[model samples]
Every structure is written in C-alpha cells, then in structure tokens.
Target: MCRWLAYSGTPVLLENILYRPRHSLIDQSLHAKMGVETTNGDGFGVGWYGTSGTAKDTPAVVREIGPAWSNRNLREIAGHVRSHLFFAHIRASTGSAVQQTNCHPFRHGRWMWMHNGAVADFQRVRRDLVLAVDPDLFLHVEGSTDSEVMFYLALTYGLADDPPGAVARMAGLVERVGHEHGIEYPLQMTVAVTDGLRLWSFRYSSQGASRSLFYSTRVETLRSLHPDLDFLREASDDTRLIVSEPLGDLPGVWNEVPESTYGVVQPEGDAMFSFAPALPA
Candidate 1:
C-alpha cells in the first residue's frame, strides 16, 4: 500500500538517502516495483532529529498532500537538512483521504512511526481500534488512517518502554477485533519506529504473505566488496537502512528480512528476533 525507508548512521544530508539513490523513495513514489500500486502519489512525509542548534531528542517533521517526486519543498529540505536518523514515506491511500494528516511517518514526542500496509477492513473496525488508544494519547489522533491509529495503539501499550512487545500487542488487538467483526486476515504491516537513537522494524500479516522489507548490508562488509563506491566508503560501520524495497542494485548491499521477524538498529549492535502477535492481556 505504501513505500517507506528508515536510515540511521553518520549524519548526512537527507538527499543522500531520499534522493541520490538509484531507486530513491522519490522514484518509488511513481515507479514502485514491489508495492501493490505502481504509484504512491497520495501523500508523503519526512521526519528527522535535529543534530544542532535545537532539541536533539524530538524530531522535526514535514508532510504534504502531494507526490514526493515533484514536491519542490521536499527536494529543498532534502538538500539542506542532515540527520543521523530519519524516516521518509510515500503513500498510496488504501481508501483514506489524500490529506497531509494521513501521511506516513507520524510522530509523537521523541518517537516516530511509519507503516507500509493496511488493517484489513479498517473502516469496519475503526471505532473499536480507536477506543483502545489511551484517552490522553487519543487526542493526538489527527489523521483517520489506520497507520496512525496503529501508532497510538502501540504507544498506549508501552511502546516507549517496550517497542516489540507493544507492537505485538497492537497487532494482536487488531486481529482480535477484526475477527470479532467477521473479517479474516485482519492485519498486514511492515512497520518502522524510532526514538532517535535506535530504530525497530517489523514485517507481518495474518494471512502469511506480507509486504516487502529489506535491511542494508553492513557498510563495513559492502566496503570490502565494492570499495570503489564513495557512499559505502564514507559510511560508518554502524550505519543502517531498513526499507520497503532495495534502494539500488548494488551487489551484496541488501538482505531480505525473514518472514515474521523484527529487528533493531542501534550503536551497540543490531539484532533480529522471531516475532508473533501476543494477544494483549
């Protein structure tokens, strides 16, 4: 339903990750090779943490109800802003209105979240899902998209303290509610979330087949394989990118995230875990 990318590494201008790649997120907006739709022009957003002259914990976000490919504002921002961690998304409405509020990479405090799939029959169970959000956080639901609802649900379930557990609970609730509504295969998602210092990504769907998700091969390894590429040469060993699709065709530069799994990228190290929905208690 959508395409998204999350980058964490040496501080670099946004264009390096959002525009300069061979198959950038901007290119995916119009010619997505793996998304269900070829065009994700409904809307787009970019969220990044500021490194200097301002708060470093809370991110600055910009969104628009327009295609990223031709959005001069996005291009301009990409040219100048530098971040060590950031998220960018291009949307293809599964039915939601094409509005700025419905864009991906929704944010709250020091956290940001984005998704690439839909909640099956979302409109049928929207109220039930929305009601599950904490009343205090529910007030922040500015958009009517299922992705945004999913974010608040995770937050309500303790995403700040336990992201993986919180998300599993969120997905579990969606499936439980969907089944109660008589909908089968009630969830589909490849989600990314971060609190500036670390990022977590997951791929899962109730019916088994889920959206595409890939993580970049380590820069240290890629450098030994393709030292001629300046990008890898300049990148740090800890740099990481998790995306809905490979950004380029560089050999040994990407690996598919296994089915039913979640991962985290951080300075200490990175890891993958078997993931499953745990019915919320």
Candidate 2:
C-alpha cells in the first residue's frame, strides 16, 4: 500500500538513506519494487530525532502533500538535516485525502510512527476504533487516515510503556471491530515506531499474509562480508535499518522480518520475537 523505512544508527545526512541508495526511499516513492503500488506519490513525510541542541524528546517532522520525488523543499531538508534515528514514508492513499496531515511518520510527544498497510474496510471500523481512543489522546488525532487512527489507538492502549504489546492490542481491537463489521482480513501492516531511542517494528495481519518487511543484517557482519563497501566500513556496529523491502539486491545485507514477528533496535543490540494480536489486559 505504501513504503517506509526506519533508521537507527550513527548520525548522518538524511539523504544518505533517503536519496543515495540505488533504491533509496526517494527512489521507492517513484519506482518501488515490492510495495503493492509501483508508485507512492500521494504525499511523504520524514521525522527525525535531531542531534543535541535540537529537539531531543519528540522528533521534528517535515511533511508535504506533494510527491516526494518532485518536492524541492524535501530535497533541501534531507540534505541539511541529520539524526541518529529517523523515519521516512511515501504514501499511496488507500482512501484518505492526499494532504499534509495524512502523511506518515506521525509524531506524538516522544514517539513517532509510520505504516505501510491498511485497516481493511477502514470506514466500516472507523467509528468503533475512534470511539476506543482515549479522549485526551483522541484530541491529537489530526488526520482521517486509518494509519493515524492506528497510531492513536496504540498510544491509548499503552504504547508509551509497552510498544509491542500496545500494537498487538491495537491490532486485536482492529480485528475485533472489523469482524463485527464483516471484514475477514481486518488488518495488513508493516509498521515502525520510535521514542527517540529504541525502535520497534512489526509485521502482521489478521488473515496471516501481512505486508513485507525487512531489517538489515548486523553491521559488523556486513563489513566482514563485503570489505569493499565503503558505507559499511564507516557505519557503527549498532547501526540498523528496517524497511518495507530490501533496499537493494545486496545478498547478505538484508533479512526478511519473518511473518507475524516484531523486532526492536536499541543501543545495546537488536532482538526479534513472535507477534500476535491480543486484547489489551
């Protein structure tokens, strides 16, 4: 439905991830190889935890209602901004308006979120799901897209304290509500989120076939695998990227995020585990 990526690593110009790769996020906006849509041009957004002296708790986000590939402001911003953690997303609206508020990398306090799939028959479940969001948090829901609703639901369910758990609960609620509305496959998503520190990503769907997702292999291992790649040599051992698809054909550099699984990236290392929807306790 859409394509997005999360970067948690040493600080570098945003363009290094958004524009430099053979199939950079910018490239994917126009020529995505794995997304449901070949082109994701409805809108785009980037949210980054800026270096010290800038915003440290919540990320500073820049979003536009135009196609990312042709946005001069986005191009300039990518070149000038750098961060240790960031998210970039290109939208292909399932049904939402193509407006800035509908762009991804949605921010709320210290957390930021983006997704690459839809809550099936969203309009049917919209009322139920929206009514479930905590009123205080619901006030911050600025867009009509299911993606934004999902974000707020996660927050309402406990994202600030338990990301993976909260997301599972959010998915549980979506499926629960969708089933009531007669939707069989209530959800399909490859999602990424961060709190300006650790990053959490998930791949899951009610029907068992979720959107595709991948995370880069260990940085040190990649360096040993391809000594000629200058980028790997300069990257920190902890650097990692989770994307909707393999950024390129680098054989040993990317690992598919197993279906129905979630992973976390932090300063210590990365961890992966099974993911399943459960009603919030």
Candidate 3:
C-alpha cells in the first residue's frame, strides 16, 4: 500500500536518508522492488524532530499531494533540514482519496506515524472502526485513509503512555470489527512510529503473514564488516533505519523483522519483541 522509512541516530541532513542512499526513499517511490506495488506515487510526507530552535519537543512535518520524485519543494527541504530522527512515507492509495491530508507520517504533537499496509476490505468496516476511536481523538482524524484511522485508534488505546500495548489493542480492535463483519484476515500493517526520542516499528497481519519490513544492521557491525565504506565510518554507532524494503542490495546490511514482531530503536541499541493482538473487551 505504501513505502516508508524511519531513521534515528546522530543528526543528519534529511536528504541523506531521503535521497542520498544508494536506493533511497525517493528511489523507492519510483522503483520499489519489494512493496506490493512497484510505484507509490500518489503522495508523500516527511516528519522530523528539529534538533535546535524553538518547539524542539515537537516535530516539523511537510506533506504534498504529489509524487516525491517530482516535488521540488520536497527536494529543497530534504537538502537543508537536519534531524536526529525522522519518518518518511510515499503512498499508493488503496481506495482512499489522494489529497495532501491523506499523505502519511501523520503528526500529533511530538509523535509521528506512518504505515505501509491496509485494512482488508476497509470500506466494509470503516464506519464501525471510526466509531471506535475515542471521541476526543476522533476530531483530530483528518484523513479518510485506513492508515490514519489506525493511528488514531492506537492513540485512543493509549499510545502516549504505552505504544506497543496501545498498538496491540488497536490491532485487536480492527480484527474484532473485521471478524464481526465476516472478514477472515482483517488487518495488514508494517508500521513506524516515533516520539522524537525513540522509534518503534511493527509488522503483523490477521493472517499471520504481514508485509515486508526490515531494519538496518547495527552501524558498528557494518563498520567492522566494511571498514572502507566512508558512509559507515561517518555514521554513528546508533544510526539505524526501519524500512519497507532494503534501501540497497547490500548483503548483511539489513535484517528482516520476523513475522508478528515489533522492534524498538534507541541510541543504546535495538530490541525486538514478539507481537500479538490483545483484543480489548
């Protein structure tokens, strides 16, 4: 349904992640090899934590209702803005309107979220799912995409306090509603979320077969393996990326997120944990 990447570590120019990689998110927008679709050109967005200046606690976001590859504004911003953490997404609409608001990397305060999957038969269950969101949060749900709805659902379930648990409850709710509507495998997702300091990614589906999701190998490990690579040397030990597909074909540079698992990435290191939907009553 889309392609996305989340980066965390030493502050780097946004272009380094969005355009400078051998197979950057910009490249993926036009030539994605691993996503369900070969192109994700409907729209795109970038959300990043500013390292200096005012409002450092919240991220700054830019979204456009055009293809990332052709967006001059996107290129200019990527070349100038620097961030310690950021989320980027390019969308290929799955039955959703392709307006600017529908672009991903949705923002709320300091938190940013994006997804690369869809709710199976979303139209059939959209009403039920929308009603499930907390009324307080519902007004903030601006887009008509299942992905945005899912983000709000996670927030409604307590994302600000416990992200993993909140996401689990959100998934459980989607499956519950989907099943009630006679959908066998109601959810599909490969999600990335960040709250300025920490990044969390998840991969799971109702059928136990989710979409592709991967995380970069530790920078230190890659450094040792390829000491001659200047990029590796320039990057700090904590530099990491969670993406829908490997940015490049570099072997050992990326690891597949196991099915039904979530990962946490911080400056200390990375950790993976088993994930399952815990339906809320």
Candidate 4:
C-alpha cells in the first residue's frame, strides 16, 4: 500500500503540491490518514514532464529510498522544478524489497504509472501474469513488485493505444489468472497513469471494496467559495489534483471518487466514469 498524488494543469513549483498545502504529500508520507498504514516511509519518487516538446525529450525523475520529509535534495529540487503534469508517490512496501528500484511512480519512456493497493495472492498468480508480458517489455522490469509487473502488463496489452481499455484488459487478466488459482478478491487498487498530457486514475477491487481516492474541485470554484484564501488565488483555474486522500480539511474541496469508477483529467476537460472488471476473452 502507498499514497500518491497526480497534478495536471498550469505549471507551478512542485512545492505548492508537495509542501505548501496544509496536509501535503510529504505530510502524508508520515501521517496518511486513510492508508492501510499511517506512515508510508519505505521510499518515495517524483516524475514530471519538463518544458521540452514531448515527454520523451523532457523527462525528469528523482527518487530515493529515504523518508521524503528528511531528504534535503528532494526539498530543494521540488521548490525549483515545475511541470504541468507530475506524479509523486510515498511507498509502504507490501512484500517488496525496500530499494530505489521498488519505489512507485515507475516510468517507461513517456508514460508513468503508480498504484496504492495490492494484488491479492500475488505470489500465486505472479508467474501467470509475468509470462503474459511481452518479452521486449518484460526485460525492462527491474523490480519484483506486483505494481511494476502490472504496468508492463498494461503496455503488453496496448496501453499506449488506449489507456483505459488497456488497463481494463490488464485488470481482467489479473482477475482471470487469480481466479484460476482460487483467490477470491483478486485486485484492490487506486491507480494513476499519465502520458505527459492526460492523466487517468482508477479506484476498483474485485470484491467491490476499493481504497479511497479523491479529486479536488476546480480552483475557480474554490475561489468563489473561499475568496479569502491566498493559495487559491495563485493557483490556475484548471489546477486539479487526484490523491489517495484529501490533502487538507477544506470542506467541500474534495470529492470521493465513487466505488468502481475511474477519472480522466485533461487540460481541456475532466470527467469521472463507471469502471468494472473486464471479462476474460
């Protein structure tokens, strides 16, 4: 289990989301309120797309296996770097080795992926799922966590062509394989994926009890509600965030993503839609 946040909007200093908020991601790294564990200090990582033309050319990432709050370099970099699309994750390893390679916000070329839940009976189904990954993509897997395997699986199934469909298929594959091994609740996840332009997040589980996920209300709307808040004034109208939990106690500023649903955030628009496990072919 882990805690993560995805930001898509006007480029702003990373600190605004990582530290400025009353209950920021760094705070969650040590005081997560809704995660299975209170402190997700196993490791942390951040991925962002720079000002370069496309994601491949401007990709920048910083990760370490130390507590995020104690990392001076992380604090310095976060305060200066800026990006319109970014992801930050604080981890709490679930059977995975605590190493830099095992941190979340895993990247592959122009895409980035992170998850906040575990696959039920991962060991039992790991073989089946790993074998399903394309060998070319399989070679890139440098870690042993189910999360990394899940990302490659999505790529194998065409994540670049259709993210939502690819993820739906990936989830279906995991469910199918897990069931064959007699595991009842095959998946539990609050996942975030980005391609430098658009962001997609999902909250779902095979058993219907998904972990918490939320998205912030539009900055414009919030400005009207809390006209005196200085932070709201500085943020862009489209500034939005999707997190494992609300970052602060701003009443009505955060909305729970419905059970079995996924959300898409883009510079043009945003929407939340129903999601269900895809049936195996």
Candidate 5:
C-alpha cells in the first residue's frame, strides 16, 4: 500500500537516503520491489528533527500531493536539510482521499510516525477505531487515512510513554474491532516511528504473514565488506536505517526483520525483540 524508511544515527543530508542510493526511497516510490504495490505515487511526506531551533525536540514535516520522484520541492529540501533522525513515506491510497494531509510521516509534537500497509477492510471498522482514539489526540488528526488514525490511536494508548506497548494495544484494539465486524486477519503493517533520539520499527499482522521490513547491517560490518566504499568508511557506528525494502543490492548490507518482530535503534546499537499484541483492558 505504501513504502517508507526511517533513519537514525549520524546527522546526514536527507538526499543521501532519499535520492543517492541505488534503490533509494525515491526509487521505491516509483518501483518498490517488496511492497504489494509497485508504485506509491499518490503523495509523499518527510519529517526530520532540527538540530538547533526553538523546536529542537520536535520535528518539521513537509508533505505534498505528488510523486516524490517528480516533486522539485522534495528534491531541493532533501539536498539541503540534515538530521540525525528522520522519516520518509510515499503513499498509495488504499481507499482514502489523496491529499497533502493524508500523506504519511505524520507528526505529533516530538514524534513522527509512518506506515507501509493498510488496515484490511478499514471502512468497516473505521468508526470504532477512530472513536477509540483519545478525544484530545483525535482533535489533532487531520487526515482521513487509516494510517494517520492508527498513529493517533498509538498516541492515545500511550505511545509517548511506551512505544511498543502502545502500538501493541493499538493493534489489539484494531483486531478486536475487525473480528467483531466478522473480518479475519484484518491488519497488515510495517511501521516506523521516532522521537528525535531513538527509532522504533515494527512488522506485524493478524495473520502470521506480514509485509517486508529490513535494517542496515552494522556500519563496521559494511566497512569490512566494502573497504573501498567511501560512505561506509565515513559513516558512524551507530548509523542505522529501517526500510520497507533494501536500498541497494549489496549482498551483506541488509537483514530482514523477522516476522512478528520489532527493532530499536539508538547510539548504543540495534536491538531486536519478539513482538505481539497486548490488548489493554
């Protein structure tokens, strides 16, 4: 339904990930290899943390209702802006209106969230899911897409306090409502979220199968594998990327996140853990 990528680590110009790689996010917007749809051209968005500003902890978001590859504004910004953590998404509307507000990498204060799949039969369960969002947060939701709704649901379930747990609760709630509507296996998603300092990504669905997700190999490992690559030698040890598909064909540079798993990336390193829905009472 969509494609997205999140970067955390050394501050680098956005163009490095959005446009420079062999199969960059811009390329994925037009030729996604792993997503259910090959092209995600309905809209695009980017959110990045500003290093020094009145809103340093918060992120600046730019969204447009156009293909990322052809958007001159996106190209110009990607070349100029730099951030240690950022989120990028290209959308293919499942059933929602195509508008800038509906673009992803949605922002809420200091958090940025994006998704690469859809809530199955979303319209059938939209009201219940939307009503579940806390009234305070619900007022901030500006889009009609299920992706934005899911983000607010996570925030309502405590994303600001515990990301993974909040997401599990959100997922559990969605599945509960979907089942009530007689739909089985009604969720599909690979989500990425960040709060300027740390990044969290998840891959899960009501069915055992889920969409593709991958993280870059350690910078050290890549340096050893491709000693001649200037970028590898220059990148920091903590540099990490979570993407819907591999950014390049480098044989040892990407590892698929296991089914039903989530990963946390910080300056310390990357950590993988099992993920499951924990419905809140």
Candidate 6:
C-alpha cells in the first residue's frame, strides 16, 4: 500500500536516488507502476544517518503530510544532505489517518523500520498483537497504523538482537492471531529494517502471493552489463538498493526477491543472503 527505498552504500546526495532516477521514489509517490494504487501521495518521510560517525547517535529525519513530489523543503534537504544509510517512503494509507506521524521509516534509537504491505484483517487481530507488545515498547507507539504496531511487536520479541528470528516470531504471532479470527491469509508484507549497519528485508504472505520486492545487482556488475548507463557509472562498486519496485527500467540491474523469502544486505562485507520461512517448531 506504499512505496519505499532503502540505500546502504557510499554517501551520496539523497536526490541521486530520490529524484534523479527515471522513476525515482518521488516519481513513484505520484506514478508508482506496481503498487496497488498508482498514486501514493498521502504523505512522505526521509530518514538518514549523517556523514560524521557521531551523527549516528542522532539520525536526521524529516517527515511531512504533503505530496513528496511537490515538497520544496524536501527537495532542498535531499539535494544537500548526504548519508550512507537512508530510507525514503511515500504513503498510500490503507486505514490510518493521514498525518506526519503515520508516515513510514519509523525510528527508534539507531534502528529504522518501514513496511510496504499490510497485516491482513488487522482490525480483527490488532488487539491481540498490541497486547503482545512489551508495555514500555507499547508506549512508544504513537500512531494507529499496523506497520508501527508490527515494528514494536518485533522489538518486543527481540528484534535488536536477532532481527530475522524476531520478525519470524512476529509473523508467527500474526498468523496465530489471524487464524483465530477466521482470516485465511493473515499476513502480507515486503518489509525493511536496519540498525544503521545491517539491513534486512522480508517478502512473505500466508497465501503465498506477496507484493513486489527487488534488490539491485552490484553496481560493478550493472556497469559491465550496461556500460552506457551513466547512473551505473556514478554509483560506488558496493552500492545496493532494495525497493518496492525497480527504481528504473534497467534490465539485469534489478532482481525480483522471491516470494516467501527474506534478503539481508550487508555493506561492510558486500554480501546478500536469502532465507526461506523458518519451519514451525
């Protein structure tokens, strides 16, 4: 129900990814090709860690309840700010109120999280999931979107220490609660979470038809494949992107993340790993 992009690589102006691409995230805010809706102008947000390692203690975040394509301040800030890890999201609210608080790439300390799909039958299972959250973490939830609730739920189940296991446990809880309410497919999501270091993305649904998710091939590989593409030339060898859809129509540059799988992108070692759903215990 939304579109988002997570970048982990060499520091570069935000606009290079948010605006310069043929179908950038800002363009997707108004012209998403694969989303359930073409226009995701409900709201938008950008979160990035600053250049100085000290700024990692305080990530720069700016969110507004306006169309990203038309936000002058967003344009100004994106053109100037530089960060190695950043997240930008354009919202298409499913059932939440349209406000800045409801925007994506929700943050907590050094960790940031965002979602592009919904927990099926959220209202039916909301109470159950909310009750499962640790009270301290529960108080941190300031919005009504299922996305934020899911983030806190992951934290409750130990996201910081073991992201994949915590997330899988959260999904298990959602499935348990949704089934109790008679919903056939209790979960649908393409989610990204990062701790200013490692990045994790998951694409899964109870029915096996998850939303679209993609990760770019290495920049060096793309350059060799399409040497004439200028965009490929500008990016660093290790530059990597995980998006709700391809940022541009560069064949061989983007690979679809298989359904029911999760991907981890680690820049320090430049490694990518895909994992299937953990077998039930």
C-alpha lDDT of all candidate models, in order? 0.93, 0.90, 0.90, 0.89, 0.90, 0.86
RMSD of each: 1.4, 1.4, 1.6, 1.4, 1.5, 2.1
> How do all models score by TM-score?
0.98, 0.97, 0.97, 0.96, 0.97, 0.94
Expressed as tens digits, the lDDT of each residue in 1-281 for candidate 1 is 99999999888999988998999999999999999999999999999997742335898899999899999999899999999889999999999999989997899999999999999999999999999999999999998999999999999999999999999999999999999999999999999999988899999999989999999998889989998988777788999999999999988999999999999997689999999998888
Q: Model 6, 114-163: lDDT tens per residue?
A: 99889887888899889999999887898889999989988988888989
* Candidate 3 lDDT tens digits, 70-145: 9999999999998888899999999899998899889987789999889989999999999999998898989899
Which stretches of model 3 miss by more than 4 angstroms? 52-56
Residue-level error in angstroms, candidate 2, position 237: 0.4
Number of colliding residue pairs in each model: 0, 0, 0, 0, 0, 0
Residue 57, model 5: lDDT of: 87
lDDT of 5 by residue, 1-281 (tens): 89888987778999988999999999998899988899999999999997653335899899999899899999999999998888999998998999989998899998889998889899999999999989998899998999999999999999989999999999999889999999998899999988788889999988989999999998998888989998777688988988899999988999999999998986576788999988877
Scored against the true structure, residue 68 in model 4 reaches a CA lDDT of: 94
Error of 6 at 84 (Å): 0.7
> Can you write out model 2's per-residue Cα lDDT over 1-281, one digit (the tens) per residue?
89999998889889888999888988898898988899999999999886762335778899988899999998899899988999999999998898889999899998899998999999888999999999999999999999999999999999988999899999999999998998989999999988888999999988888888989989889988889998887899999999987788877988889999999998677899999999866
Error of 2 at 34 (Å): 0.9
- Candidate 2: segments with Cα more than 4 A from true spot: 53-56
List model 4 lDDT by residue over 1-281, tens digit each.
89999998778889989998889999998898999999999999999898553645535777899999899998998989988889999999989899999998888988999999999989899999999999999989999899999999989888898888888989999999998999998999999998887899999999898889999998899999999998787888878899999989977799999999988987678888898767534
Give the range where candidate 5 is weakest over 10 consecutive residues by summed lDDT.
49-58
> Candidate 6: where are CA atoms >4 Å away?
53-56, 268-281
